[model samples]
Target: MANALRTFDADVGSAPMDMLSALFEARGWQCDVHSTEEISGKVKGSWATYQLRCIWRREDNVLQLLCLPDIRVSPEKRAPATDLLALVNEQMWLGHFELWSDGGMLLFRHAAMLGDEGLLSLTQAQALVETAIEECDRFYPAFQFVLWSDKSPKDALTSAMVDAAGEA
Candidate 1:
């Protein structure tokens, strides 16, 4: 695939957001360019299809990505979900999970600061999306266990950590 990110110079006002949209289009993600500063899409994972949103803050030179699984934590379950997030975030090398208190929506969030140059490579964008999705996939079952099955955060995390040696 061509690096859509490389096509634009910094002089282009919306270069970062434009390159982001092109990269998503090239990868055939269900991309929506909400505005010059935002893009949203869906990504299929082993456990679920995640909703992805990317927002570019020109003033701060920050590019933020949010990945959300198709699950909601009821008010009663938010405390346990919060525990699970703490456990889950502790182990991650990239994005961290967040539980929106008012709405009880769980999501993975990561942001990159582009500095004054305000440049992002396609590879960096890919990594940001992939890392969010991957971490969501890896921890999805734990969230299920906590929210639905009433497992303790530690136990749910333990259950989710088990890896099958090989496909049958």
Candidate 2:
């Protein structure tokens, strides 16, 4: 078996990080371009405010994204948080949730291999940001339940998955 050929141009290597910065600014999010390889920003979501960061690795041709929700899991709650993350990660397709060992901060992380040419489209960048925010919003309540309300991982996941039909 053989892999399909992916096309790329020399200029493709230079545009991704800039494009990402522009996209973030266009969305009115607070965007900061920290050198040519990284950008960080803040976005407001329904359930919580989020910190979003993107790092472009030129040598590896990879783009890494991290989205952190406002909620933080205390050290004591890290056990249940880990359980909840495991269950949540199993249900994810594009990205997975992780509890950082340093501060027990929960975040959604995804990385894309842009191939040898390192081409990244604006649409791809937009999708990455949107997906992270959407997933975090969907699962925020479950984290709250497990960390704050002392709910079991299964029960918290169930509560978070329930879709409310309409506004009261």
Candidate 3:
């Protein structure tokens, strides 16, 4: 087996970070570009405030997103929370939520392998964030139901996904 060749341009070292910064800025997000390796911002959705963090691995051309939902899962609820996250993870397309048991914290995480290439595209950066927001927004209510309402994982997912309103 051989290692895959990275396609990133040597001169375009900042492409990924720059693209992320610009994309978040365009959305009026105040992001902290404290380092080339990471950029973070907070997006307030209708349901909860989400903290979005993007980390770039220059050596591998991999950009990963760590989105923390505002809710905190407690130790007592860890068992059911695991069930809830598992169900939601099965339904997700972009990322999955992980339980950091040490703190009973849950976070939605995803990564994009850009591979060795030229400068990252603005569209690519935007797509990553947009997908994250969409997935987080869609599933947040389910997490609430599990953590707060004592709802079963199956029912939580159903409540989160059900569209009761027919064509108006």
lDDT of 1 by residue, 1-168 (tens): 556545654344345677778777777788889898899998888899999999999899999999999789998888889888999999998779998876788999999987797877666777788899888988998999998899999999988887421323
Task: Report residue 13 deviation for candidate 2 (angstroms).
Answer: 8.4
TM-score of each: 0.88, 0.88, 0.86
Comparing 1 with 3 on TM-score, the higher-scoring candidate is 1
Clashes of each: 0, 0, 5
- How many Å off is the CA of 121 in candidate 1? 0.6
Regions of candidate 1 where Cα sits further than 4 Å from its true position:
2-14, 164-168
Tens digits of per-residue lDDT for model 2, 11-93: 34445677777677667789889888999999999798899999988999999999999677898898898999999998899
RMSD of each: 3.2, 6.9, 7.5
After TM-score superposition, the amount by which residue 145's alpha carbon in candidate 2 deviates from its true location, in angstroms, is: 0.6
Return the top candidate by TM-score: 1
Which residue pairs show backbone clashes in model 1? Answer: none
Question: Could you tell which candidate, 1 or 2, scores higher by TM-score?
Answer: 1
